[model samples]
Target: MHLILEQGDLTTVAVDAIVNAANSSLLGGGGVDGAIHAAAGPRLLEACRELRRTTLPDGLPVGEAVATPGFDLPAAWVIHTVGPNRHAGQTDPELLVSCFGRSLDVAADLRARTVAFPAVGAGVYGWAADDVARAGVAAVRSWDDANPGALDEVRFVLFGPAVLAAFEDALASV
Candidate 1:
């Protein structure tokens, strides 16, 4: 199924899980990470810290995810995935796609039918919104192809109009 697009508060979504655009620390920084952490409450940080201790290399690979309880948010769980940092050609476009791919994989494993995702790598990482949107659409298309009927709903919860426009444009092409 193709992913749905929306601009809203991720904290209020009723999906089974939500994807956070986390940093390497997993401690919660600015943008979506901070918003998720704040909404999920302080316990979320402690849980992340515990997960961090066991899961080495700081963050999971580009196409993988680590999950934690939602704590206080409406969702049941939070799937934290580390996205590529945009810099002088360092960020692979494929890795950007992988971030979405892996997040869905993790959500599927949790038996989640619906998921909400923030625009990955768009804020502090400095990835262009349009590029991120394209990658996200490609990732969701790949996932839907592999697992038909596995995901009932996927929502791209954009933070702003530019991000929403990027996703809309990408979705239009799909």
Candidate 2:
């Protein structure tokens, strides 16, 4: 896989899949999750509701990922993953890394050649942007090394200069 960095709205990224930094409920929360749900329209919520009613009645677990159609968005699929909430005492960096790795796994399962990701566990989750970037970049790089041609491209679609700078540093170092 090819790793790249871009500071932009993840909803508009033209990839096969975009990773949502979702809360456990997966019902549309703030940040990237809300943006994605809003951009994808009502069907996205309905799909999430169906997932909840059927498969994920207990809501999605932290560091795990599940997929739904992208609906009105540019991407073909939306891969939602819950990040560890540091305020809730979920402080392990491994948990944050799992979010990226598992999302990549879902994208690989869907046979997606390209994927975009947000800064999971960052901001409101209480994780530093630098920490999130390091874990995310390392996880993706590790997966790419192990999987080889599984994906053609993976982009860190960050929200601002700070996060983008962190990811850029991680990409260079890790």
Query: Which one wins on TM-score?
Result: 2
Q: What does candidate 2's lDDT look like per residue over 1-174, in tens digits?
A: 678899999999999999999989889999888999999999999999999999999999999999999999999999999999999999999999999999999999999999999999997999999999999999998998899999999999999999999998888886
lDDT of 1 by residue, 1-174 (tens): 547899898888998999998876788988889999999999999998887788654656654678899989999999998888876354788888988999999999999999999999888888899999999998999899999999999999988998999999999998
Residue 21 of model 2 has an lDDT of 92
Task: Report per-prediction Cα RMSD to one decimal.
Answer: 1.4, 0.6
Model 1: how far residue 144 lies from native, Å: 0.6
- TM-score, prediction 2: 0.99
What lDDT is obtained when candidate 1 is compared to the true structure?
A: 0.88
Q: Estimate each model's TM-score.
A: 0.95, 0.99
Per-residue lDDT, model 2, residue 15, is 96
User: What local lDDT score does residue 133 receive in model 2, on the 0 to 100 scale?
Assistant: 93
